[model samples]
Target: MDPQDGYDWQPQQTGYVPPQHRPRAQVPRVDAGRLWAGGAMTALVAALTAVVGLLLIRGVLGIPVFAPEGDGAMGDASTGVLAMGAAFAALVATALLHLLMLATPQPGTFFVWIVTLATAVMVLLPFTTSAPLDARIGSAALYLVIGIAIGSLLSAAGRSATRQDF
Candidate 1:
């Protein structure tokens, strides 16, 4: 009834009450199937790089790259080596890209560019060397084999990583 009572109001005091079980956020689940597909995709990219390398030499450069026409400018052995080496370098680059590109977890622009440049050099290197172009190309193939080995190692590592549950 007093006028002063209307003017004065009191605030309530409360304690924080946390739930017995706090709700947790869900993480986006990654399927194992995608991992296999990713690996295959990477390998295909590498192989295609090798094939394109051969074609570029024949197409863009107008060079008899893979096909052994005559004793090439670099001679047979040297040219073959260069070709194989370039392919190998591409394979290595692909694996490295896949492993190192943690953000993407796949091949990206950097890997492709590096491999492309190396492949081009391998394609063209024999011409400058004393050896024949075929030899250089064959040498390049050898390097490709080495790269394949490196990729195999990386694939195994990827497989192991995927088997782990997040």
Candidate 2:
């Protein structure tokens, strides 16, 4: 017989042997009570995000869903539909974010700041296309700020909620 075969594979001493592969314990479930308010907030935020996304899609696509009474520099069926869609999406996102926040705790001030920025962008999207060349730049800036604001706030809330130990 080979020398290796005669020897035992297991360790000779076993006072305190650690497992080579330890399974991770399951995370504790968050209580429904704890999540109620945050869940609502998260839902709102998600709705807002969706709304903004829809508006952007409509604006670029020029979907003629609605027919304005008369043509105007500011108003058009396609434009209106697009803008409305955007606003709605944002609201939806707002709901989503609200729900997310309900689960997690985070910095409220910073969160709101982001929401304001994204909302501002969506709010001024109509102005974005109709403005003079110089004004267009400003509109773009506004949209950027608003988008960032919304994104930041939503992410912050979500992070906080998810991070909860419970």
Candidate 3:
């Protein structure tokens, strides 16, 4: 038999063995409980802010809380509306965080971009709609405040909730 035929293809038994491939770092798992808690807190705060701001604008500043079409007053932007909107925003935000955590390597970074863009869209709604100038400004301010509160809180919550220990 030839010498080459008897040789094996296994790695050589040299004392200085080359290093094996290093496993990739583990991705952190997101804690949904903490995230949802933040969402709940944000929803409460945003809803409160909306109601208080609406009162200040309409009650204090004498700005009627009217529809975007410059129609009659909006019945004080009722608590039901504000609470439901805030809760809905929070839910949507939480869902988005869950998606990013599962599918994206950089969930926090993407989360910020997503929240910011959505807030910007919200901020622009009054201007594009048929709302009056004063009403538009007031509504836009409320939207800005609510968006900032929700976005910042949720993003922070998402960042803090992720861990490698899973």
Highest TM-score, which number?
Answer: 3
lDDT, candidate 3, 42-160, per-residue tens: 78887777777776777666665543333223343464587579768977898898889889978889988888888889888889977668878887888888888888888888888
In angstroms, the error of model 1 at 132 is 14
Residue-level lDDT for 32 in candidate 1: 44
Total residue pair clashes for candidate 3? 0
lDDT of 2 by residue, 1-166 (tens): 2254553343456443234423455453434433434445544544454445434433443332122324333335544453444445455555655554555444354456656665665556656364454434434543454455446654554444443341
Give residue 100's error in model 2 in angstroms. Answer: 11
Query: For every model shown, what is its TM-score relative to the native structure?
Result: 0.33, 0.34, 0.77
Runs of candidate 2 with Cα error greater than 4 angstroms are: 1-22, 25-87, 94-130, 163-166
RMSD of each: 12.0, 11.9, 6.5
lDDT of each: 0.48, 0.46, 0.75
Residue 26, candidate 1: alpha-carbon lDDT: 43
Best by lDDT: 3
